[model samples]
Target: EEVKEKAQDVKKEAEVKAEEVKEEVKEKAQAVKEEVKEEVKEEKAEIENKIASTGNYPDLITSLKNNPWTSGDLNTRVKFEDIRRQVTLHEEEITDLPLDKIKTSLSPESLVDFLNMTSAKPTILNRKEDTSYEFTTRDPKEIDLIKKRYGLLDREIDKITSVLIFDKEGQKLKEVKDVLAEGKNRIYMETKF
Candidate 1:
């Protein structure tokens, strides 16, 4: 009995730490998004300057290919003719370079797994009694903070509009830097301990 209780306590603590890491991942993702935006802007400006300096079709084509710039939605390898037609028709936004597709698409919850917060077995979350049916936290400090932030004191629970449960299935790969198309479901757990 004592061993079982200790194991539960450890699992709970690990889960709490995972939640904290998830928040950190969100912050990092936002930062990465900002950095990628700046880099793309710089790359686009440099390419545009080069193209303007060329002042000739042949030189422009060479500059386009050598510079390695791409329209956000276009293929990795684009011809000068295709670029000219696209620009003429205004069908594409060539200046907008989406360099970090993964960072933009990936949810913060999934990023936590990539960060490898710890070798935590999430079986502790399998118990039904451990889940939240509402957006309320059980922690006194967090609850107080939320109440203060939202300016709600002793507010009664209004009827729930909807509860959505998203299920995620994936194997945590080791030493992988590839972008994952999908994301994991975040477990928002609030404990009194």
Candidate 2:
């Protein structure tokens, strides 16, 4: 009977020890879970900044204003909608150049083509803050970029005649030319900074 009693005592102690170990394991798991939640909370804001917002001029305004990527003299990544425009940045030199009022020396080969263009009064869709933009015309030759009211950066569009799409390795992907189409005609081009 004494031997049986000792065995029962040992069994009771073993069960208590097992319960204590189980509770310790649960506590450690809860601590790890809390640590993980804290890490995600810390990274949430930074991750939100990297997420890109894509839309037309109005939709992009908020993104540009809040962009964390744009610091002093840092190049910002931008893209225009299909056929409307797209801005893929290359070359790392950052310059905020100021231009004096002067006629551009660089002439486009399509200048002769532009002479035949009908007179147009287009409502400009681009803002001065935009890194790149496109001008789409509803009617034939109805878009004119030469405006006295445009800011210095906006006037840079006058210098660009065509867009040459290139891959990362400098291989030419596509070249946009001055073409008159039946539907919306776009002058998709890139102005070099």
Candidate 3:
């Protein structure tokens, strides 16, 4: 009777241990599933941020192509409008510069003063209707500075334009991908039991 009780106790202990192990495994599996879900969510968020930053205009373009409509063509129209606005603003800013005031501020001995006093500024000298005067400075350092500034501005404009283009392209690609995915699903459904 003592041996039988000892065996029963051992069986009960083994069963309890098994239950504990099963519970631990379940908890671990749940933890792993949650971790995977969080990682997937983070990855998706990152991609969304990238797409948003680039303007995702391509999607609009793609939608337009897939289903053409006069009013629904937002991508091209918006791009054109943005370019026009930027050009206009640039022109206005350039015109607002006080060129005459700047020239008067310089001493008569300075090269700019000499040019101003003599009206040697190419734009002032070459007043031809068809020909436009291009400013060319002999000082390499000054020229380099000017070139750098010009390049910087050019790069900024290019960056903006690129983002717009990227958006349009991305949108189109997404639409195409969706269509392909649908077709693949249809094919899979037709083939599978």
Candidate 4:
């Protein structure tokens, strides 16, 4: 009878130990689950941030469109158009003017002064009596037009450069977000299994 009672006690002790082990395992599993959830939340937040940053691309495009140099200024645009017409007329006149007459008509001193004012580099032509200066003009009036156009072009280029930098940063963020998202998904799948 004593042996029987001792065997029963041993069985009860073993059962209690098994229950304790089960409770410990359950707590550990809960801890792991909470950790995974926190990680997933963090990953989602990071992805959301990446998406928001990329979403600013449209605003950048709008800012470029609304820039005063590009679209907002009307006077510069009209001036550029007028200069373009004048340049066309001048090009036609160039064909009629004899090369020597054209050379003689343009005063060397005035030409040099104009070059200095415009900060243009003068090409020196080899001549016997008088030094012939050739001013290679891509339509002086058209050049003025492009100068006006540059106000717009410069702003656009700057905006574009900014947007490109933003895009690169956004892309890197997106890649990181993707990796995090994938990791989260893997964790989710593992949890399910």
Candidate 5:
């Protein structure tokens, strides 16, 4: 009878020890899982922060690519149309700004002194008998700078023989430039007729 009791007691102790080990393992697993989650959160945040620091067009594309909606997950919901609308609105706002403001904002280097250095005057002359108009500039460099700055490179000083000039009231003035290779006074245009 005493042997039986001893055997029962040893079995109970072993069972209790096994249960305790299982609990310990469960607790360790839970702890490891939490640590892994924390590490993942930290890494994700680090990557996002790194990307955010690059505030440029390429970074914007990267951010869109990194989104859950773009990761082949059809179930993820995103407001892409709203984002596109906002971008359009911002573009419209930029386009509505005055020319001076746009120039001040986009001028890479201040060429104010260079612009002031030119002593050029644009003149438009029209003769009743002539079929064409005449537009001329004393300093072609100034005209070049103005045209280049305003994205009007199509009209060039040397190449353009005759051009139509518009007044404030939108009247077409006949203009011509006299092509002078070497002279004290450079005449921009001249019409034979």
Candidate 6:
């Protein structure tokens, strides 16, 4: 009878130990499940942020396609739209150059091409505060039109004895004596400082 009692006590202890182990395993499983849930939530949030950041491309491309000014052959329009998207995306990286009184201008088509060419990466040089801007276009006619419209300064360097400055309407603003004969042309004849 004593042996039977001892055996029963031992059996009870083993059952208690088994229950404790089962509870511990259940707690561990719950912790693991919670960890997985948190990780999934974090991943989902990252994906949402990524989508928000880049979601404007499709809509912008659509707008470009529908734009009357940009309309053309389907292939060409598509190429331009792609370039436009790249430009818009990286516009913040392009430096804002301080412009002077000499307003530089370019045709719409040429400007689009230039932007497309430089959209991959942007590198703009910082100029002095009083720097004037001079623009050159491949079309000489366009240059003349811009000069007429914006009163841009004209600098001549081919054995010219004088430099002439003209207003927007071709009126002579000033004529400066060119003392240096090195053929170095200057658009702005005088510095403010």
Q: Each candidate's TM vs. the true structure?
A: 0.28, 0.29, 0.32, 0.29, 0.31, 0.30
Worst 10 residues of 3 by lDDT: 184-193
State the displacement of the C-alpha of residue 76, model 5, in Å, after optimal TM-score superposition: 28
Per-prediction backbone clash count: 0, 2, 9, 0, 12, 0
lDDT of 5 at 92: 32
Query: lDDT value for candidate 6?
Result: 0.33
Model 6: per-residue Cα lDDT over 78-132, one tens digit each: 0011232333212223232112222222222322232222212222222442211
Task: Rank candidates by lDDT, best first.
Answer: 5, 2, 6, 1, 4, 3
Task: Candidate 1: list runs displaced more than 4 Å.
Answer: 53-55, 58-193
Q: Between candidates 3 and 5, which one is better according to lDDT?
A: 5
Residue-wise C-alpha lDDT for candidate 2, range 30-58, written one tens digit per residue: 99999999987665565454333333332
1-193: candidate 5 lDDT, tens digit per residue: 9999999999999999999999999999999999999997886666555343223223222422253121122111111112323332222333322333222221211122222334433244434533332333446675555445434455433422223332333222222122322222222222111
Per-residue CA lDDT of candidate 3, range 14-39, in tens? 99999999999999999999999999
> How many steric overlaps does candidate 2 have?
2
lDDT of each: 0.32, 0.34, 0.30, 0.31, 0.37, 0.33
Model 3 residue 43 lDDT score: 61
lDDT of 2 at 88: 28
Better of 5 and 6 by lDDT: 5
- All predictions: root-mean-square deviation over Cα? 30.8, 17.2, 25.1, 28.5, 24.1, 23.1
Better-scoring candidate (lDDT), 2 or 3:
2
Candidate 5 lDDT trough over 10 residues, lowest sum? 73-82
